[model samples]
Target: MSISRRNFAIGLSALTLTACNSTLGTTSNSGAPKPKGLPADLRPHLNRDYAAWVASFRNRALSQGITESTLNAAFRDTGYLPGVIKRDRNQTEFTRTLEDYLSIAASDERISKGRAAFTRHRSTLEKLEQSYGVDAEIICAIWGLESYYGDRKGDIPVISATSTLAFDGRRGSFYEKQLIAALKILQNGDITPSRMTGSWAGAMGHTQFIPTSYQSFAVDYTGDGRRDIWSDDPSDALASTAAYLKRSGWTRGTKWGRELAAGETASRVLQPQAGGPRFAVTGNFNAIKRYNNSDSYAIGVGHLSDRIAGAGPLRTPFPPDKYGLTKDDRIALQSRLTSNGYDTGGADGVLGPKSRAAIADYQRSLGLDPSGDPSQQLLQTLS
Candidate 1:
């Protein structure tokens, strides 16, 4: 999941801290140093360093043809965001089986909301489908998965998030490119710097386009001279997603994929979990992967779109997940965990990292392996 959806869905694993080479003392490479007298008043020094870095970056943006006005506006109050680094390093909450992922990604509630959104934007979706030759439902599914049909279009400032990641130096070069691309977007006047907000990793808009992806694929489909994906109106966002799919070799009038029953002649079958549902994916499935690059994510988009378009659930039954527990058992386990002081977030029944951490904590108390894999025996033990 390399897309914004992936960035948001997957955790950043651990917080990444770079060596700040300012006049202030460098963070210790060894154990915490003894109190080395009164710590220097390093705030001003660090502030100046950050300001200088921003100035240098602004110069680079200028060299790349971003207007001085855009750079100035985008960086007016630019400062390092430590929270962005924390979130960027956050690992996913839970490891999920395909079934578990589907339970959340293509759940009934999501599908219902998706249908409503689809109906609300039917005219616009149809026109985009006709123009781009990509299915309307797929676009809607991408929108739903990326930002919950525009209901959760993220809140982190794009400039701060990207710049902090660039400064952090963990993935410095990649994030630097994103930062530059974001400035280019500002220069293009697609959105005001004040409104250029997105996920902590800088995936922006309803469809979660990273700055570079937006540069390559975003479109001003609304003809308003601005490819405004940040607006409440999702017309441009949806249309941009359609354009991306179309350009990614989306086949006109072909299904993204079909659920393959046992013995079905499938060109390519992907069964992420043993004994779980299998799918015969098409080129369109690959096209969706170009959006997020996760097999589970691509399937979620394809299956959710199929559901929104009135297709039935997969006839093939999914086995218990890797934890050897079914979906209902997982829900019960979450409820028990929360009630037992583990606080598995909510009983939404998706086993993300939080739920697993809770489970691991409980396991540790009992001297268990702390693998955090839920089993019927663990549920009974908790009971």
Candidate 2:
């Protein structure tokens, strides 16, 4: 649900469309005007089969002790979202090298923003750390990575998104469980249905806790009788993340890990990239991984937290990639390609889809095969 393991690139476009409608009926059932600025696929359309599915699901909701009033409010403006299904089915499965992961995770912009956010909320974060026994820097790092310090908390309605996934049935049982938990959250008066917005997959709030995780770990740190993570004030969400880490067995006073120098040894060492830096990790590293189950993710969080705490970058350099290019070379390639009229989005040292397309375009211009691959030769050619 944290999405750290899936793709580190946050989709800024989706975050811009928060004003889109959430109900199944665009203009009939609620008589609300059709939502503007939303993609057609994301808008709800009439589907009798989906209607029947919801009708049957209501019985199950009732059996689970969800009151009739809660069900009605939760489902009032909710509807099947085709875009959610599309996104679920078409998830891009790819791996990022530890170097690239760290580049994005601790990029100059993220580090700068993180420092400001940490400074702004230092008191709250430190208090949460004090209470939960989790490190404050770690909490800030998760917030930085999860929602860019609350800049991109998703806008899709959770009930609609969860119910659509539940009806789609590909991961029906899993989503059904989420839908039920969401309803329970609604029944608990933590958030209203209209305000219960989150990611397309139902990951919500500052740290993107899925409903089940929220039920288990979320806290009302504000003491307002509501565990409100969706609001601009991130006290509750930050506290919840600390609580989650505490629950996940974060050891107090233990470092997550540190990069090992040449000839350095430790009780447990991890070299995610074979020829890159080796890390001496602790139980706290595993605790970070419990938030997102990936070695790269754990390293990203640890390294970013360290950076936020004023540490320098890794001392050792990573070997050239399979394409025989280094991070600097990749960044140069992207910068050159963009200057040549083919945009690679930004020179982030990551050859993602836009970068690859730019490379392919440059290759075609040279009467070469458009393989969209990067190489030392290609970098030289661009130079």
Task: Identify the leading candidate in terms of TM-score.
Answer: 2
Each model's RMSD to truth, in Å? 8.1, 3.8
lDDT of 2 by residue, 45-71 (tens): 567788899999999999999999999
Which segments of model 1 are wrong by more than 4 Å?
Answer: 1-46, 92-95, 336-342, 357-373, 381-383
User: What lDDT would each prediction earn against the true structure?
Assistant: 0.75, 0.82
lDDT of 1 by residue, 1-383 (tens): 35442343243110110111111122222232311221233111234555667778777777888888887778664456666666556544554578767777888878999999999999999999999999999999888877778766666668867887787788888888999999988888789876897766778888878898888888888799999988898988888888888888899988888888788878798998888888889999988887776788889889999999999887887777666777778889999988888978777667766888999999999999999778899999877
lDDT of 1 at 187: 84
Cα shift from native, residue 206, model 2 (Å):
0.3
Which parts of model 2 are misplaced by more than 4 Å? 1-29, 33-37
**What TM-score does candidate 1 reach?**
0.82
